[model samples]
Target: MPDSFGRYPNMNISEYLDFFARAYGLRGASRREAVERVPDFTELGDLVNKPIDTLSKGMSQRLCPGRTLIHDPDVLILDEPAAGLDPRARVELRELIRLLASKLQKPGPDQLTHSHRAG
Candidate 1:
């Protein structure tokens, strides 16, 4: 996997989001909607046209989680995702991450839950 900084490039923030969404399994308009909710993500999309090093540290951190979600990995491992975020941004980001976890599932009855109940 590419480092977080290596992910965002000279593309629209939407385009990169679309790219990563496809990399996972989410399709069509749903993934697009999820990405748009990110705070200041629109401006960040514009900023994506510039080199990443030019971004503020908070912006860079916010972008990294989006990049990880792009792939829709079966398991997501985040380290200090809210470290530098302000209270509001951290809360928003936390909600977004929760949504991502829910979406990443294969949409069944949650076999893990069923198995434990059965046992």
Candidate 2:
């Protein structure tokens, strides 16, 4: 999985996503598949050509998960996925996560956990 630096400061979203797809040797239809998969999982369609550094925190957060999913991994592990999101972004991210879970194969016991506390 990629970390926060997964996005390049000087690269636009399409360029950044293409870079990773190529790095993973995703060519031809595979490359297009990897590239197309990101926007399906993220709400960054309008920002696809925007520079990475110009994105908001919520926008930037979507990049990491998109990069992580680019290679179509069999398993996904997310830590603090909603740590800093505003309420709307948090809800959007939660829905996306749930969607991902439904699409992926069933996970084993203890593979997923959720813990929330009210302040």
Scored by TM-score, the top model is 2
Q: Against the correct fold, how does model 1 do in TM-score?
A: 0.47
Residues 1-119, model 1: lDDT tens digits: 22235545466555666666776776767776655644243236556445555666666666666667554455555555666567776666666556654654353122111111111
Steric clash pairs (candidate 2) = none
What does candidate 2's lDDT look like per residue over 67-107, in tens digits? 75676666666666777677887777667766654543345
Q: Candidate 2 — which residues are off by over 4 angstroms? A: 1-3, 101-119
TM-score of each: 0.47, 0.74
lDDT of 1 at 79: 51
Q: Give the clashing residue pairs of candidate 1, or none.
A: 20-70
- For each candidate, the alpha-carbon lDDT, in order, equals 0.54, 0.69
lDDT of 1: 0.54
